[model samples]
Target: MKINGFRGRLITADHADYDTARAVWNGAVDRRPRLIARCGGSADVAAAVRFARDHDLEIAVRGGGHNVAGTAVCEDGIVIDLSAMRAVRVDPAGRTARVQGGALWGDVDHTTQAHALATTGGIVSHTGVAGLTLGGGIGFLMRAHGLTVDNLLAAEVVTAEGDVVRASADEHPDLFWALRGGGGNFGVVSSFRFALHPVGPTVLAGPIFWAADDTTEVLRFYRDFAAEAPDELGTVVRLGTVPPLPAIPAELHWRPAVAVICCYAGAVDDGERAVRALRRFGTPLVDLLAPTRYAAFQAATDDTVLHGWHYYWKSTNLAGLSDDTIAVITDHAYAARSPRSYSAMFHMGGAVARVPQDATAYAGREVAHNIIIDGVWLPAESGKHAAAETAWARRFLQALQPHRATGVYVNFLDSDDDTGRVREAYGDRTYRRLAEVKAKYDPDNAFHHNKNIGPG
Candidate 1:
C-alpha cells in the first residue's frame, strides 16, 4: 500500500484496531479495508481522495457509520474516516447552520438548539448529517417544513480531481440540484449549510399504544386520519411487540401492539386540540403523548436500539394504503420473527409533496404513505430472521402493487438487493441527469458506498 504524508492516522489490516474500525452499524457486513484514513480536516479528506484515485482504490466514506447497508466501510480498498472532523456552527441571524461531514444529528441539534434553531434531520440522532441529508432526510419536522435536502442551502464538496468547490443554487447549480436528493454519487461533501427553522425547545409529542387485536381498526383509522391531518401533526403507525419499558404493563411486555407515534410542531394548546381526536378515537392501552422538548422527542427512541444488531429493511412508496395493503401489513406484523421487528407506515404527502417532481432528484412527489418492513434480530438468529423479514417485506410490497410508486427510498436500501430498484428510486430523467453529474464530479465512481448512479 502507498502511504502519503498526511497528518491523519493510517491503519492497515495488520493493525489490531483495523478490525474494530472497519466494522459497520450492521453486524451482517464484515469488510476489511486495506487502509483506514482517520481524517482530521478537509485537507486530510482531499489527500485521501487523491491517494485513492491515484492508486485505483475503491473508497468508502465513514461519517457516523450508521448506513443500514453498511456502506460506510468497504472491502479491500481505502476507507476515509471522518469521525474526527465533527464540527457544527450555527448562525442564528441567518437562520442557517453549517455542519461538518462527520457530525451526527445529535451534534447538530445540540449546537443549533442553543440558538433556538434546527434543521430537518432523521428520527435517530445518531444518524450522520452527510449521509442522511444527501439521501433526502425525512423526519418529524418533515410535515411542517420539508425534507433535509430541501433545507440545504449550500455545500462544500471535494470532487474526484481533489479540488473543493461550493455547490448551491447560484454556484455549480446543476451539481447542487443533483446533490439535493442524489446519494453520494456526485462528490464527497465536506460541509453542508442548511436553512434552519424555529422548532421548539419544547413540542407536543409521544406514542399512543393499542392492543394487537385492534391492529386492523387502528390502521384503518390512522390511514384516514393521517391523510386529513394538519401539517403540524406528523405521525408514524408502527406494529410491533410492546417493549419491556416501565410505562408498559408487565402482561403487555413482549406482546404485539399497534402504536401511533405523533409529533405536533405547534403551540401546546393547538397541539393538544390537534391530537385530541386521536386520543378519543380508540381505547388506548397507554397514552404517553404530552408536551416535551423537541430535542427530547427526537432523542426519545434513540437509546432503545443498539448498533451492530442485525437489520434488514425494505420500503415502498404508496399512493395510499388500500385495504389489501393493510391486510398484508397486519399479517406480516404477526409473522415477524423478532419482537424488535416491525411494519411501519408513515403519511408522506404534506410538505414533501408540495415540491415539484423536477425540483429535485427525489421522485416520489405524489406518494401518500412510506411503508417499511424492518427486521432486527440477534446475531445468532439473524439468518432465519433475515429470510423471514425478506419474505414478509417482499410479500407486503407485492400486495401493495396497485398503490406502489415507481421507486423506493435510497436510505433504506440493502446492499445486496436489486440494482434495478436503485434505478426506480430516481425516475428515468432524474437518473440520466444524475448520471451526467456523476460523470462530471466522479467519472470513475470513487464514492460508490451509497445508492449509486454510474458515470455517464
Candidate 2:
C-alpha cells in the first residue's frame, strides 16, 4: 500500500479516523474506501492518482465533500481527500484569487472580502468551490456576475495520465473550456484562479415571505418582476414550511410559506430602489430584507443547511413560470413529504443569459428559472421517511416534466443511475464534444464518479 513520492497521511479502515474521514455532506452515503489519501498539495494529489491507477483502484476525489450525490467517497477504492490543502491567495491589484481546490466558498469569501472583492459562489458557505464551479455554480452573485465557472480564469490540474498541467484561455484553451462546466471527468483540479469583481463588505439582501395561501399572487408578481429586474438584483423563490428558527415569529414557525430571497449586489441606494417593489408586494408574513454584510448574507442559510442531512435534489430548467407551472409547483410544495423539503425557483436571466450557450460546457443558458426540488429528511428518521421523501421528489419532478426544458443542471441531479439524464443535461452536440474531450483527457473514464461523459 505504498504510495511512491507521496508525502501525506494515508488512512486505511483500521485507522482511528477512518469512519470520520469517510463521512461526506450527505448522511445517506456510508462508504468505506480501501484507502484515503489525505492529500496535502498538488504533489500529494498527483501521487495519489498514480497510486490509484497503478493499483487498479476506483478513484474518488474529495474537496469540501459537499456533493449531494456523495460522489466524493467510494466503497473499496482510493479517495484522494484534498481537505488539507486549503490556501487562498488574493491578488488585490489583479482582482483575482488563486484558491486551492479544497477551499470552500467561505474560505474564498473570507479572503476576497478583505480586499472588498468577490465572485460568484454557492449559497451555503461550506459548499466546495471546486465541485460547485466545475458543475456550473449558481449563487446570489449569479445575476450581477455570472456562474462560478464564468468567473474562473484558470486551473492547475493533474490529469488522469498522472501529468500536472495548467488550463486557461491562453493555454490549453479547449481543456479550459471543458474545465469550466465539465465535471471532474477530465482530471483532478489542484487549484483555481478566479477573476474577482468589486462587490461589497455590505449589500442589501434577505428574504421576504408570504403565506402559502398567497402563493399564486406572489408568484405572478415574481414572474413578471424578476424577468425585467436589473442584473444586480438576484432573487430566488422558495416554497416550503418555515423552519422553527429564532428569527421567525413564534406563531409562524412551521407554517407553509412562499418566500423570495433577494440579494442586491450593488450600491445600497440602487439596491434599495431595486428591491423596493418586491418588498411592497403582497401581505408578507416576514420581511427580513435589510442592508447586510456580503459575507453574512452569503452564510445566512448555513445554520439550516448543515452537513449530514439526507438530501435528494431534482432539478430542471424551466421554460418560464407559466400559470400551469406555478400551479404544479404550489400543489407539490403543499404535499411535500417532509416539512424540511422545499422547491427553489432561481431567477436567472441577467448576466447568466448574457453568456452564450456554447461559451462553456454548462447548458440551459437562456432559461428563465432554474427549478430545484430538494427532498430532505433527517437521517435519524431515514428508515421511517427516506422512501417517501425520494418518491415525493420523483413524482413532483414528473409533474413538472411538461413545463421543463430539455436541459437540466448536471450538479443538481441526484440519481446516480441516470446516464441518459446526464446526456440531456448537455444536448447532443455538446455531449459529443465532451465525449471527445474525455477521449483526449481520460479515455479510460478514470474519473467516472461524477455525471460522466465517457469517451464514445
Candidate 3:
C-alpha cells in the first residue's frame, strides 16, 4: 500500500528509530507498529488520521506514552506519535493554560507554576496531560481544585474521520462531556485548554511513615482523620516495602511501612495546623512533611516509577475504608514479592464529589476512596519473575472484591476490553451515553486501544 500527503516524520519498520519509536512506558508491552508518524503539530495529526483512514489501517495514538497498560503502541498498524509537540502556553491574565497533547504533567506544572497557577495533574511528572485528563485526572490538588477534567475549558481534537474540531461546554456539548473522562476512544486530542487556579509556589507536603506493625493503628487514624479533613488536605495511604534509596534513612531501608503522603494546598500556617493531628498520630518512623514547591513534590517519586519497568495495575473504588477492608489490605501488603509493589488508598471526596455524578462522564464521584494494587518489578533475565509479581497483585485484588464499590476510576483500569470491568467503571447509564458518543465520533472504533466503550 502506498501512502502520501503526510507532512510529518513518517517512519516505516525499516527506519533506524523504529524500535525506539514503538517502545512505551510499560516494558511488558512489546508490540511493533508497521509505521509511526511523529506529528509536529495539529495539522500533522489530522494528516496522519486521514492517511490511516484511507489505508484502512488500525490506529494507535501516542502522547507522552506513559499509560501503564501500554496502549500507546499497536501491532502491525499506524501510530500517531505526538511526543514531539510538547508546547505549553500559559495565560496568566485568564488564569489558564493551553497545552499540547504531548506535554507531560511536569511541562504544564512548571509553566503554570511560573504564573503561580496550576490545574490538577498526575503525580508522576512525566505522565501525559492528555491521557490523564481525559481519564479523569487525579492528583495532589484534586481535593482543593477537583480533577483535571473539571478544569478543562476546551480541546482541539482530530476525529476518526480526520476532521479537526473543538469541544467545550458550548460547542459539541456531548463530545465535551465524553472527553472529560472517556479515555482516548473518540479522537486524538491535539491541544487542551485548562482552567488554572492559585495552587502554590510552595505547599506543605510529603510523606509520614510508621512501621508496618503499626498498620492497624495507623489505618484507623487515617480512616477517621480523612473523614473530616479539610478540602485543602489531599492524602493517600500507602502500604509497601521501603526501597533502599538515598532519600530514606539507611537504617530503615527495606523495612515494611504504612505511610500517609500529604499535599496541603492552603496557607502554610493553615497546612501546619491541618496536618498536626496526622503528624502526632502514632510514633511515626519518619516525618518528611514540610513546605515545598508543588512541582518538586510532584516529581519526588519519579525515580521509583521510571519508564522501562514492567507494570501491572489493579484498582477498585470503595464506599469508605472499613475496619474489615483494612485488615484484608494489610494482610496482602506483606506478601508482595517486589519492593516496588504496593497497595495504595487514595482519599476521594471534597471537590471531586461536590460535582454531581452526572455532570460529566467521570463516574464514582461519591466514592469515598480508591485502592490501587500496583505490581512493579525490575527487568529480569528471561522474564522469570513476571508471573509471580502479577499473581501477587491479582490475589491482592481478589481479596478486596467483597469491599469493592460498583465503579472504578477509568484511569486506573488495566483491561482493554468491553467487559464488565469497563461497564462497572462508568455504570450502565453513563456507559450507554458513552457508546452513543463513541458511535457518533468514531463509528468504526478506530481508537479502541483504551478501555473501550463500543459504538453500539
Candidate 4:
C-alpha cells in the first residue's frame, strides 16, 4: 500500500514515531492508523486520497488534530496530516484572510491582528479554524458578526474523487453552502478565505466572577442582560469552580463560581458603560473587566486547559432558558465531580439570527442560547465523571424540552450520541438538502468522521 512517487512523508506502523504521531488532543481516543501521510500540499493530499481509495483503506484527515472525538486519526487506515501547511495570508484593504487547513485560531488571530481585524473564531485560541468553521463556529464575536462559517468567503477543497477545486457563492455554490457548516463530510478543506471585522487594537472585555451561591441571581440577571445587550456586546455565562490562582482569594479557590465573560466590540466609552451595569448588579468576587487588546482577551484562558485532558462535551440550542431549565442547570452545577467541569450558555441571537435559515447549511440561527455542558476530568476519573455528566445533560435537556431546537451543534457532539440526533440538529428540509449534497459530492461516504449524513 505504498505510492513510491508521491511527494509526502508516508509513515507505516513500523515508523519510529508512529505512536507519537497517532495521538490526538483528547487522551481518551486511541486509534492506530496503518499508514499516515504527512501531506505537504494539495497535490500530496490528492495523491494520498487516491491511494487510500484504491486500497480500500479507511481515510482520516487531520488538520490541527484537535477533534475531541479523535476523528482526525483512523483506527486502521490512512491519515492525511495537514499540520505542515499552516500558512495565513491577510488582505487588510479587502478585510479578508486566507487560512490554511492546519492553522489554529491563534494563527488566524495573529495574522488578522496585524491589520487590526479578525474573523469569527472559537473562544479557545488552540482550536483549529477548519473544524470550528466547518461545524458552525460560535464565539465572542458571533452576536456582533455571525458564525465563523458566515464569514467564510471561499474554500479550496480536495473532494472524494481526488479533485482540487474552489467552492464559493458563484462557483460550486451547493458545495460552498455545505462546507460552511456541514462539517468534514464532503471533502477535505485545504484552505479557507474569510471576511474579517474590526474587533480591537484595544477593547473592553474580560471575566467577572461571583460566588456559586449567587448562581441563580447571576444567571437570571445574565439572561435579561444578554437578551437586551447591544449587538456589539457578546457574553457567555459559565458556572464552575474558581481556579486556584494567586489572583483569586484563598477562600474562593476551588469554590463554585458564576462567571460572565464579556466582550464589547464597539467604542471604548460605550463598552465601559455597558459593562458597568453588569459589574454594579452583582457582588462580585472578582471583576477582571477592563480595556485590553482583543488578542490578549482571546488568549486569556489559553493556559487553564491543556491538551490530553479527558473531555466530554454536549451542546444544545434553546429558544430561551426557562425557570425549569435554570433549576436543572443549578442542580447539576453543584454536583460536578471535577472542579474544571462547567456548564456555559452563550447568547446566540443577533446578526446571526437575522440570517435566513435557508441561506446556508447552518440551521440553528433561530435559537436564542447555545448551551454546552463540559465534563473535564483526569484520565483516572473519566469513567466516574462520564455517567454523571450524561445524566445531568439529559435531565437538563428534558427540562428544556419545549424550548430545545431541532438542530444541534456538530462540534460539541459526543461519540455514543444517537446518529438520528444529527438530523434533528439540521431540521427536516435542511437535513434532506445536506443528504443530497452528500450524495452529489461524496457518494462513497469517504468523509464520514463528523456528524455525518450518509449519501442519498
Most accurate candidate by lDDT: 2
What lDDT is obtained when candidate 1 is compared to the true structure? Answer: 0.83
Lowest summed lDDT across 10 adjacent residues in model 3 is found at: 411-420
TM-score of each: 0.96, 0.98, 0.97, 0.96
lDDT for each residue of candidate 3 in 1-456, tens digit (9 for 90 to 100): 334556778888888898988999888789989899999988889889988888888898999998887888988989999999899999999998999999999999899999888999998899999899999998888998999999999999999988999999999989999999988989999999999999889989999989999998899888889998999999988899776656679898768999899999888899999999999988999898999999999998888787898888888898567899889988998787777888788998999999988888999798889988888888772266578778888888889989888888888877443145888889899999999999999999988877788997
Residue 231 miss distance in model 2 (angstroms):
0.2
lDDT (Cα, tens digit) per residue for candidate 2, span 138-180: 9989988999999999999999988899999998888898988
**lDDT of candidates 1 onward, in order:** 0.83, 0.90, 0.88, 0.84
**Candidate 4 C-alpha lDDT tens digits along 218-274:** 888888888888988989888888877565678888888889999998887999988
Lowest summed-lDDT stretch of 10 residues in model 1? 299-308
**Per-residue alpha-carbon lDDT of candidate 1 for residues 302-382, written as tens digits (9 for 90 to 100):** 755567878777888876677876777777676776777877777777898898888888777778878777778878887
On TM-score, the leading prediction is 2
RMSD from true fold, candidate 1: 1.6
Query: Which candidate order results from sorting by TM-score in descending order?
Result: 2, 3, 1, 4
What is the alpha-carbon lDDT for the whole of candidate 4? 0.84
The regions of model 4 sitting more than 4 angstroms off are 245-251, 383-395
Clashes of each: 0, 0, 0, 3
